[model samples]
Target: MQIHAHYNGAKPDPYLINHHLEDNRLSPESALKIIATSEPGGEAVGLPEFVFLNPQADPAPDKPLQYMIKELFVKETFRSAGTGRALMNWVIAHAQAAGCARMDWHVKPTNEAGIRFCRSFGADAVAGRVSFRLMLR
Candidate 1:
């Protein structure tokens, strides 16, 4: 919720968030969600969500499956404590183990800290692309 507020300027409804998580849990092959804690059964201090795109669904038959990181959030208190880096490294390792072709994600243009962290991982921004959204609600 804090991450959503930070990126979207609003705190999303708890019910909606729960519904989304439940749906993801029901479809494990399509998405992966991780919660990080400081110790055994501790409170969650970080989360990372990933979506898998099956190569068979794409028109390009030769393409391999890809992983898309939908969100990576570490509580403000945990920022710069290596939590984010650890989560990213774990995700990358998981992807590699699954033989994923690549991993991709988007960062808000004004999120300088997020941008720096991503760049530190050797992520490059693609040019000539514009993000658009259509709200149905």
Candidate 2:
């Protein structure tokens, strides 16, 4: 199966993520919003089938209204096999193509999969990673 930019990605199958995340009400919706927008405003890489990446350019360039990301999730679907890796590889290649200095994200302290996933893309922590986010909405 070819990877298409699917919004809402196959309804958060029980096998994919922990059950609690799906029922968290806002998290799934937020995930939906990210998928729907295609260019999830805050994603380090704006939503698009493909986006231009530059390591030299600061990904989180402050825009008055435009959202940016520090800890972006490089999503992939397991069923499609290597699709997730494909997406991430593309992103990494894009970054190199655009001459990005580097890419990084902080995985959860306890998220072994997340850590593993990021490492698969050859990601490393340049500074303090594995922190917390206190979203007050």
Q: Among these predicted structures, which one has the highest lDDT?
A: 1
Q: What are the lDDT figures for the candidates, one per model?
A: 0.79, 0.44
| lDDT string, candidate 1, 43-137, tens digits | 68888887778755543444477888888888888889999999999888888887787888888898898899999998888688677889999
Worst 10 residues of 1 by lDDT: 55-64
In model 1, residue pairs whose N, Cα or C atoms come closer than 3 Å (at least 3 residues apart or on different chains), thus clashing, are none
Q: What TM-score would you give candidate 2 relative to the actual structure?
A: 0.41
Worst 10 residues of 2 by lDDT: 62-71
Misplaced by over 4 Å in model 1 are 9-16, 23-32, 38-41, 55-63
Candidate with maximal TM-score: 1
TM-score per candidate, in order? Answer: 0.78, 0.41
